[model samples]
Target: MTDNRTDPPFVADEGPMLHSWLDWQRETLAVKCARLSQDQLRLRSAEPSTMSLLGLVRHMTDVERYWFRNVLTGENTPGIYWTDRHPDGEFDLVDTASAEEAFARWQAEIANARELSSGLPLDLVGKGLRGGEEVSLRWILIHMTNEYARHNGHADLIRERIDGATGE
Candidate 1:
């Protein structure tokens, strides 16, 4: 895949630095999934594990919506790939999922997240609560960076297994 990730800045203010890293992590996952076939995107990582490139995309879509819309702005939105009855639906129900649709939703959520958080102070607490505790914009940015980094690691392995492709 042609990598389009913007390297995180080495010297910058806290907000830009955090956002750059988060954006970098986001692009990392996209790079891993790029140029793959539908079946290839849904290839499972291993037995008993439903993790796949497409699953990661679906999962991140929900993650962005949860943090930015539901938690950040107090919007009561529901999961796109999961529910109480199927907690792992994002990964488990990917056998026939549409890669195109998943990517579109994921990108849209990312755009919405950017708009919601733009120019908001890092120390400003969100309107919603996570685990019944107030969370700051700074914390959300850090948490999201960590979340994407962890998942991109999985994407790395899955992509390699699918086509022997590997990179940062």
Candidate 2:
């Protein structure tokens, strides 16, 4: 909890409102990267570790695709981050990738997610990969939201280390 005041959960009035929250987390993750210099954004969080904010942005972009359309909806589209040669390449996108390119990719990923999730009904059924089980559309929304929340925290930490900036 960032503060003693905890807000109530989003009302179930509309789907867009709830999804906006999910988008908010991703936007907040980008917030930490917004004002940094390209050099700063490219700098690794630690030596020999390529976990820069840029990398996180790309990873989250891949994550948005993985969860929304691929896994939950079973699109089976090739994943951006999962490749045979470098399974963990998502974490190693440090230098040689500019902040502008990273932001552009993130924006595109979020756009794709928004489009994919737009038509899903609240109670829509999706077959999950866990033992080939089925899950609710609402559940996937919450799961995606939670996934964004967790990674956003990591983004916050990485941002603070980058230049002492913090929040959301």
Candidate topping lDDT:
1
Q: Model 1 over residues 1-168: C-alpha lDDT tens digits?
A: 799788999999999999999999999999999999999999999988999999999999999999999888999999999999999999999999999999999999999999999999999899999999999999999999999999999999999999999998
lDDT tens digits by residue: candidate 2, 100-141: 876887788788878877878868776445357677767777
lDDT for model 1? 0.95
**TM-score of candidate 1 against the unseen true structure:** 0.98
Q: How many clashing pairs per prediction, in order?
A: 0, 0
